[model samples]
Target: MITLVRTNDIVLISLIEALLREARVPLFVADAHVSAVEGSIGAFPRRVMVPEDHAAQARRLLRDAGLGAELAPSPGGS
Candidate 1:
């Protein structure tokens, strides 16, 4: 099964998705809800999923894009 990860914002989400695509990471849409933070109704809050194997690499890619911090995963999950 695929795993879903949240992007901080719609623009960041799109950027990360595009970058992931360019990197050849397989993607799937899990959810794409609107975020109230953007306050435009359809402003943001989209989420996406990739194959489980690619999750780490996806987070690393986002970290590389300056979206979030990357560290070794904790004992339980990937």
Candidate 2:
């Protein structure tokens, strides 16, 4: 799991998720409960995870959407 992006902005999360999904990149939602708890308090941090193999693809897909840069190297990759 990695924190690809963080923001107290609720709309951004949904937008990013939808964009990623539309691009055929599956992402795991993390700290979702926290987001609800904080109610976007000063920007709640959310975690998004993908398999090691899909990590790079995920990053690229997100970047292409103008989300943010890749956070880390995938420990598992081709």
Candidate 3:
């Protein structure tokens, strides 16, 4: 999996999740339960991830939706 976005903003994560779902892109949210363990202090940022094969398309989708600034750098540095 590749990290597409990582942040403490739950709203942004939800919005991105919806966008990805609407576009039919598979995704997984990492560290989502950390908040429960950490009392919602927001220290651990949740991560949005997609399969390696779908990273580029997912990044493009988020970028087009005015979320380019939230995108994580690709593993290959592209």
- Winner by TM-score: 3
Clash pairs, candidate 1, are none
Residue lDDT tens for model 3, 1-78: 999999889899999999999989999999989855886678889999999998988999988999999999999887
Report the Cα lDDT for candidate 2.
0.65
Give the poorly placed runs of model 3, Cα more than 4 Å off: none
Candidate 2: residue 6 Cα off by (Å): 3.7
Consecutive 10-residue window with the lowest summed lDDT within model 2: 69-78
For candidate 3, give the lDDT of residue 7: 89
Report model 2's TM-score to 2 decimal places: 0.65
**lDDT scores in order:** 0.62, 0.65, 0.91
lDDT of 3: 0.91
What is the per-residue lDDT of model 2 for residues 1-78, given as tens digits with 9 covering 90 to 100? 555555555677777778768877667777778778877465567666665566667777777777654344445432
Error of 1 at 48 (Å): 1.4
Worst 10 residues of 1 by lDDT: 69-78
- In lDDT terms, which candidate is top? 3
TM-score preference between candidates 1 and 3, better one: 3
List, residue by residue over 12-71, the lDDT tens digit for candidate 1.
567767988999988865445335555665545455777778877776776787766422
Give the deviation of candidate 2 from the true structure as CA RMSD. 3.6
